[model samples]
Target: MAAYPENNRTWQIIHNARKGGYAVGGFCVYNAEGVLAVIKAAERCRSPAMIQFFPWTLHFHGPAFIKYAAEVARAASVPISIHLDHCLKPSDADLALECAFDSIMVDGSMYDEEGNIKYVKSVVDRAKDKGITVEAELGRMEGGEDGLPTIDLESVFTDPDMAADFVKKTGVHFLAPSFGNVHGPYPAGGAEKHWRLDRLEKIHAALGDATPLVLHGTHPLSDEMIRVGMARGMVKVNQNRNVRNGYHEYIAENCTKVELTTLQVEAVEAYSKGVERLMVEVFDSAGKA
Candidate 1:
């Protein structure tokens, strides 16, 4: 059995963080090195953190990787949750549950309101039986991450009324509503377009404090914006672009002289450093475990 079961502590981690005025960072990783980097950073900072795997990551690494991540989470000094991020299908959610993932994000935002709710409810019903937490997105986010398509920003910002109704009907533990955030990098000189706290606050007001909010595509937001968002109930922030960039930068800078074995070590160190900064500096989650 896992040290921290998804159904119980995973939900608590977000709720506690929100109540205590801190935001936990959800770091996405594709390989063992990336996993180690996130766990090591969380351990060093004593932060409650989450290691997330996207749909493509599961396809690339297989179900065995989830067990590997569970082992890492078990061994870590601080609390860690193994989460399946951006799962689009019920089968994918079932696979993650079968692999013992602590939490799963069911992304049915591509569909209309009724369709999204039905899809998310199906996953939630299954997950609840096994004690897993479900996160569902309400509005479509523009720009793609991990091969997903870019949606139009104008039509996709989440509505507060719709958000409240969605949560009530779906029984999702966390909500990822599109305020203005997108996946991957922001357009050049367009950082302002990526975050809208007024919209976020409205959602918070509608949903109230009990349901913790999640921020996806947070890599491009400034630290102040992140702080502002968290202050209004954003409990989990997903960061991938910076971590991947840091890992690649380190490997590119030193791969010529380093042995292949050393490359992995260097990548872990680089990724860990970036994750550490995000936890300790940006999210203010360090030492909150």
Candidate 2:
């Protein structure tokens, strides 16, 4: 068997969450403050965390920024890992593999099942040598996040049995299944009306505890619904706009009133507060460091 999903920082934190009956938040970040916010929240709550960056950051902030984020996160008292989210292009995956990230979400959802498996398997093969675990999205998620592409096609739910086969074939450490979960905010009905917990349950059952489930499309998901996903085996919950809104609100309100340094400090605090709440209340990861 491959030595992947075993020794890496991301794998270790997530594995601990799995064993401890809790979930770690995959907090997506774009800048230095975003990095600090996650570290602050994880340390304050004593929770394990994954600081995620989209592929845009790779080109915008560059690899040095990713290394800085990883350095900062790894230095925290709590268990924190740096992860590259939604590496859509194989080239981006290639670039991410050379960075300081502890994990990379290899998104092959745009491809056919066989193509996705082959693509993910290729990255997984290379990632093992770099000591970085990999996360693979099995089905296409509708809508999009800040840096991800918006797919006009309907959301494709992941097949439970196929998820297992994909995991086995690709040697992926984490699985983000699309089961009625869109990328952005839900339509008229909220996540409560759209999320298919039954499908998630089946996927979890198919993969068991060996492979962790990642909850995506969680912008407006209720705390109760989040808790329900955890019950069904979502060990890593991806939080993008969900936790960063507080930071945005603070920045918008205080940009003209406060000094740049002061604004950044307080803004990070606001972001951390949002992350800390989830760690303490919903994820049950606080004090699990």
Candidate 3:
């Protein structure tokens, strides 16, 4: 098995990724294709990155899938972090950590305040022993993910004060607090375009400079919004939907007379450029590796 990052803390890697002036890409993977696409992009850019999966998808791919992906990433010359995203159950959290994931995110923000704190603390204790970084959600996400239902502004907002307390109590290394972000693509002409940047800034201030904040469901937002998010302490930005859509679109546009393998390579190449563009232009992370 490959060794974990020398830091052994996801926050340290992301804090460096942020101070280095480039947002760390947390690409969500469902299968080998997703993992391959992300790693290739990171390597081509000569940057450090993260690959993660929603726990619901883990049921289909199995926990062994993370181990396989970790080994593949370990063989790469660039630094890579493997993470389990939005794990709701303790068993799932324990399994991912045992499988040697560098980070585990226990997303219990949908629960009430007491429930959220309790879950975060329990997972933190479990993950700490294994030298795995833990991330706890402070706010509820707007759109559905992992079969969870969508939440609106009234339902999904995170209390800045509560978020600070949650982080302190749980001793989580990273925080994924929702600020008008969703799980799926954003709606055209919706409030998502104008994300709650001020709210996010406030949350960052409450959490202080030490804890890195992750931005979830950032695909459909505009470049300006994404850049603002990075400046406001969003060290890690999740960008799975954009990658999937870009890859699929390229294959469909160019596969008229090509074989499946050719189309697959073409999609990979296209997605690589697409990811590179986002990292270099929007995230300003071209040479921060």
Candidate 4:
């Protein structure tokens, strides 16, 4: 292993994607089934994967659960890293840095530009000591996810002009720029109409390949749009429910018919199948392990 991010699992996975001209999915999971699904899919496809969790997992499941997730992820046959997604609170960041996460997304969007920079920088400095790479949101992503709350504030898009400076000042490893991407479902026109690919391109051009770009708000995104992001600079694609639809369907249909134990087994298998499809289809990470 090398120093800092070079030694980190998520960094190397994302960097490998950038070099290979593809994007790696950071699968956001909530439970044991989700964790198992990511590992199984990555191993089956021989893809480098990252399992992501919201702040809820860290708190609800506790630190022990995070350790368990990280342990299994690290032991995977292929490169599988564990990440904490949308760590909004400073306390959450503190708790996450102490865990076994390979990387963490420091969500400082609640603060102003200066406050966000300082908060992220402080986390980055502390994270270095623990050998964890940091990913932070440059501007506020609208809507809410499983663990996040709804914001009444207006959406703030990341300025391409300030993109490079934000990365330079914060010392963050990955940049998740908010360019008309929402956390949950899209508005009337869907992602095709709402996504600002041109703005995304500008952000990527400003940062270049030095700081890998992360794609968020992919609930109902089309595969074509995903390709557009990867072609631009999205190296790490954070996925939540889109990849688990099959598993959710299976559970909903078979929960009453199948035994509890069998339900979980088949559910995870279904989940892995969906993830494997994305591995080969959208992300194109299959066989890159």
- Candidate 1 lDDT score at position 44: 90
For model 3, how does the per-residue alpha-carbon lDDT over 243-276 read when each residue is reduced to its tens digit? 6778878877888878878887778777777777
Clashing pairs in 4: none
Q: Which regions of candidate 1 fall more than 4 Å away from where they truly are?
A: 1-7
lDDT string, candidate 4, 1-289, tens digits: 4887798888899999999988899999989999999999999999999999988987798999999998998889999999999988999999998899989999889899999999999999999999999999998888879878788777788999888999999999999999988989888998888888889999999998889999999998999989988888999998999989999999999999989999999999999998999899999999999
The lowest-lDDT stretch of 10 consecutive residues in candidate 3 is: 1-10
- Candidate 2, residues 1-289, lDDT tens digits: the string is 4365567889999989999999999998888998999999998888899999999999998999999998888789988999999999999999999999999999998899999999999999999899999999998898879868899888899999999999999999999998888888899888888888889999999999889999998878999989988999999999988888888999999999999999999999999999999999999999899
Q: What local lDDT does model 4 show for residue 258?
A: 89
Q: What's the TM-score of every candidate structure? A: 0.93, 0.97, 0.90, 0.98
lDDT for residue 151 in candidate 3, whole number 0-100: 69
lDDT, model 3, position 274: 71
Each model's C-alpha lDDT? Answer: 0.84, 0.91, 0.78, 0.92
State candidate 4's TM-score.
0.98
In model 2, what is the error at residue 135, expressed in angstroms?
0.3
Ranking of all candidate structures by their TM-score, best first: 4, 2, 1, 3
Reference-based TM-score, model 3? 0.90
Decreasing lDDT order of the candidates: 4, 2, 1, 3
lDDT of 1 at 288: 93
lDDT of 1 by residue, 31-127 (tens): 8988899998998998999999898867788898888898879788888988988998777777877886889999998789999999999888888
